[model samples]
Target: MKKDENLKKVAIAAPQLHRHKVKLKIGNWKKHFDFNYVNTIIALALNDFDDKIFFYINGYLITSNNLYLVVQTTEKSAEEMVTKIENQIINLLKTNPQKLKENRSEVSIIADDENLFYAARKPLFKIYPLENDHLIKLITGQKVTLPYFDRDLEHLKNRIRNHPFCSAINYLGGIGPVKVTLFKDQIDPEI
Candidate 1:
């Protein structure tokens, strides 16, 4: 798949510019679902939402890594953005060809600026309720500061590339060693 020149720039600017982030857990990683298909639908919906908003696979989590769509909003509140995004995704899924089930999603705020996915910060272990189920156990079981590891961005990109859906769509910037996909509002949008 050919890379869109405009989107390339958005990918680079995503981490630093998009401060207000909302992590979306569309489906369960433990259970089987057409990831590419679902993500494509979600991506299309996001593309229709806003151009500056960015989307990516939360591959940092060691478990239950779900699709994360982060929107950079200057006017709208985070709660409002999350609700709109969820609603947009739901509306799109209504016409899905395969009757995609499991709409139970966890949408929350990434309050940490040191987060790898949200910020240009080093890819480290930042626990979220949806992805890391054993976070509480990790906190209680260990005495140290959760043993956070400094993950290489390249390594994370490689891991994402290995996924079967890496080459699924151009919008999925994870395709072939990329990080995130920015659906520019000015582009040939979808929903």
Candidate 2:
């Protein structure tokens, strides 16, 4: 596990700027990444347990083959968080056996507390969709947005639409990345 070494390198280069995220590598289940089913199941479970979830960064690959979730809390460790996530996923499978088949996974703590993998890049340039039109600024000067990928909304509308319960997000500034949760309704129908 070179995770500690990688974090050390990142720390020396970008002190105090980091993201606490988990990279879930699931094998043999890429076909289950469907929005109508798989993605929705994950979203609903996370939404149901919202207090523990910090951000829904994205799917690791364009093929929707991996899950990139950002979460931070002093109450739990990386292993604990992964255990909870795995438990949620197992619960999902137990409740809906037809959603997906058997699978294997490897979860790791990929970065600093607030710095997601995206902002971890040397020069960040990806546009994150805010849950709503409302944008925010951290104590440092940076923009943060929680991209809302709604199903029924138009491409443009979906970009602006947020979850019914939450609409607030912070901009990605020198502080790295902030927590942007996925609302139960944020699943993309077209995904």
Instruction: Report clashes for each candidate as comma-separated counts.
Output: 0, 17
**Candidate No. with top lDDT:** 1
Question: How many clashes (backbone atoms < 3 Å, residues ≥3 apart in a chain or on different chains) does model 2 have?
Answer: 17
lDDT (Cα atoms) of all candidates against the true structure: 0.37, 0.35
CA-only RMSD, every prediction:
16.6, 17.1
Q: What digit string (tens of lDDT, one per residue) describes model 1 on residues 1-191?
A: 55675465534443533233334444332232354555565555555554544433222212234543333354345455555555665555444434222444633332331231222111212323333323211211211132555355334444534544332223443343323333433222111
10 residues in a row with least lDDT, candidate 2:
132-141
Relative to the true structure, candidate 2 has a C-alpha RMSD (angstroms) of 17.1
Cα RMSD (Å) between model 1 and the true structure?
16.6
